[model samples]
Target: MKTTAPRDQSRFAPDTASNGSVSPKNLLIAVDDSNATTRALQYVGRLLRETPNVSITLFHVLNPMPRELMEHGGSENPDMEHQLGEQLRKDQQEWMHMEETLEYPILERALERLRDTGFPTDRVTLKLGYAGDVVDTILDEVRSGGYGTLVVTRHGPPGAARLFSSSIADRLSRDLSGIALWVIE
Candidate 1:
């Protein structure tokens, strides 16, 4: 089923155009297929309904393997390290395969939702990578694609009272400059 939220009714609208003639503002929405991500997407959809000349991009970052595990040798066999490395490679491949299988369906659903809510199709982008490196990847995309705003959902499980802290989002907000960041709860 489709979901939506109310548009912000503030009088002061943010300028979206880099050049004249109402160019579409690229908006990045980070998604993990989590409830928080879905809420964020709905929030963005509502915002788009209120704001003209804007586009939405959906992004999902796969959670990465733990650094500590990678750094320290946990296996007993000498060949265990090599086997683990191979296993990781296999896991990554499987993850990518899963992404490939799931990507189109997810995008199609998102696009449908956005379109139904009056957003344009030419503006959507779907990207996948390690969750730890998502901020960097997003920044790179912003620089390369000229996105003016990023809309991310505050990390919180359903029925939770507080937003959870994400290392990637924290790092991005701290390090990145010259882009508008919106965190939806």
Candidate 2:
């Protein structure tokens, strides 16, 4: 695929162009419920906390119930189908609420960690999305947001567990181009 000139702006240290416009100063960091993810955030916090011009976007993807699971099944009573439909709506709402309940704490914890590093809250953005593939979601966010830098954690034990599924870092390194990708240890 044809691509444009690379911004190549480092996530930790943003680069400024001749026109004084910062390239890739907007960083997109993928957040998960893993220590490695936290470490990535901490590493970034330590590096960019003092920079007043950079903006950080904390990104996370939530996995929702499968389509079949959400589908309403057949019912015995004549009105059961309608009731099931109503129940399905209620269930979906509850499911979304529960996701919000769980997601906020994780995002908040990440935000607090960044805040502790002296990163200003005003410059920080919290983004949450629901998708099947985490890596693809992040990549889509990076592309849509026009982020110059993408930050992600290198999940450990890079063998067996990932034998079937590719690691996020690996997929990103292979797919991403013309942008800065930071794989935090």
Candidate 3:
């Protein structure tokens, strides 16, 4: 008996489906000023240093003031509503100013560190977003930004506290199943 090969062999050759097709990996690194965050960034920096077709977005989620607090500014008097409104305006102004000044250093430090570790500066960007819930905010970013992977450091409280309370890492691992997640301890 003689055997015959299929006319269409393109299915078997996966790499040849598209010639010179580059799928750039977009990495979202969720960070704060913590040792674990530093470790995560360092790891990625070293791992991705020589790899081509990779870009990084350093993301920070800032928790905005609660609505209740914003309404009254912690004052009990009803007459202080106007005062609270003024205070709120001042606080918002302060926040914008802080975003202009304070947020730059955080991104700068991370950028410098990544550069030191050999990651290209041109492939990196910084994003700052505000939300009341941290985990939700991160997940939102991952979905909206089309990030290929999420890198976060363990920020759970130490020892006994963690046993009673859930960490952001824990929630993220459970909730963010669609996206690739790399959690550094």
lDDT of candidate 3 over 53-135, digit per residue (tens): 67787776654655654554456776687787888888776765565456546656777777888988777777665667788
What would the TM-score be for candidate 1 when compared with the true structure?
Answer: 0.58
Report lDDT (CA) for all predictions.
0.57, 0.69, 0.67
Clashes of each: 0, 0, 0
The candidate scoring highest on TM-score is: 2
Which candidate, 1 or 3, has the higher lDDT? 3
Question: After superposing candidate 1, which stretches have Cα over 4 Å from the reference?
Answer: 1-24, 65-95, 102-109, 130-132, 158-166
Scanning candidate 1 in windows of ten residues, the lowest lDDT window is 1-10
lDDT of 1 by residue, 81-125 (tens): 788878777776666566555554554555566666655555555
lDDT of 2 by residue, 35-143 (tens): 7777788889889988877888777676655685478887888799888888888887777667766776666777887777777777777767566677777777776
Per-candidate TM equals 0.58, 0.72, 0.70
Badly placed stretches (over 4 Å) of model 2 are 1-23, 73-89, 156-166
* Clashes by residue pair, model 2: none
